[model samples]
Target chain A: DAGITQSPRHKVTETGTPVTLRCHQTENHRYMYWYRQDPGHGLRLIHYSYGVKDTDKGEVSDGYSVSRSKTEDFLLTLESATSSQTSVYFCAIREAGAYEQYFGPGTRLTVT
Target chain B: AQTVTQSQPEMSVQEAETVTLSCTYDTSESDYYLFWYKQPPSRQMILVIRQEAYKQQNATENRFSVNFQKAAKSFSLKISDSQLGDAAMYFCAYRSYTNAGKSTFGDGTTLTVKP
Candidate 1:
């Protein structure tokens, strides 16, 4: 929970349209991550940010782009949505020098 | 690259009984961390327990305890006197000290507690 919120808790978008999910945190943690949960794949990291304007790709970052312009907000964008992109997205954060990462409620994204 | 493996896809235990969930990991780094996370129907990832590679002592949180074998690369979670609320999808995770924020997680084990 950790004072983390993801916008558009349930989203339905058409294929080929652009979609963006937002993660906002109030704890001012140093690390933020975006992950997608699938049936068989478990949870796969899509992107993460260490600081403002500093972002990096994760294992499944092929179709996802991320930006962290501010400390509290991190955005994940899909250039063109696809059926494969439909899944539950989770946002996680960790404080400086901490080992445990806390997660948000999650956003369910669907593309038809 | 590190990988976590949860061999048991699902487990069940009777109320007031005990159940152990198995977890094995492959890692080349000597200094890292291991964790157990539980996600119930709400899908909220909750931290169950954590084990550091350097610590030889096993960690215990009330009824939740961990059996950590550093040499065997095995970490198992044991829940004593199980309750219905303890039933959830448990995931084993690994985080290297070098890559602090990035965690590698296992497929997961769905636990069911019978009344």
Candidate 2:
């Protein structure tokens, strides 16, 4: 389980509304990432944070924003939710001495 | 950019038997890392196994092992003594040794464990 948790496991909201998803990790890993999972796309990274306040855009960063103000808590926000953004979101953490990444349970979001 | 390919979209394996999932990758770097990730219905992504390009010996984790063919740019996962719990969506991933944050993943192979 990796002691990782994602808030609002499931959410259904109308378009043009704002949404935010939170990911909390007890492991205090150095790296955190936000990804979206779709039918044929598998998992695509949206954004990643190497350290607090230091983030970078991933392959699919449009329409999504992330913030890591402190360790253990990473937040993903959608300024204006759209139907195309409806998908499962996953958060992952990479530890210092390990090549593997631990993922959170995931948050399923649906935009109407 | 690194890319991983999982040729098998779906595979079925009998319980207590063995199955192999094929994975091929494209990368210009000589040193990199290959990984196999399993995502069960629960939606948690777990690392099944990992192989380092610099190491000639393949990496093995209990019932899961990888065959790393550096020359062929292929890294396949072989499951021995398959169990019902092994049924999941398997994803092949690639990461450059120099960078740990970026990872490229395959579409995924759904493995069904036949009883």
Return the top candidate by TM-score. Answer: 1
Candidate 1: count of backbone clashes, pairs at least 3 residues apart or interchain:
0
Candidate 1 is scored at a TM of 0.98
- A-chain TM-score per prediction? 0.97, 0.97
Question: What DockQ does each listed candidate score?
Answer: 0.70, 0.67
True contacts kept of each: 0.52, 0.48
Model 1, which residues run further than 4 Å from truth? none
Give the distance in Å from residue B97's predicted Cα in candidate 1 to where it truly belongs. 1.0
Worst 10 residues of 1 chain A by lDDT: A39-48
| lDDT of every predicted structure (CA atoms) | 0.92, 0.91
Assign candidate 1 its CAPRI class. Answer: medium
Interface C-alpha RMSD, model 1: 1.2
* DockQ metric, candidate 1: 0.70
Model 2 residue runs over 4 Å out of place are: none
Clashes of each: 0, 0
Model 1 lDDT tens row, A2-25? 899999899999999999999999
Chain B TM-score for all candidates, comma-separated: 0.98, 0.97
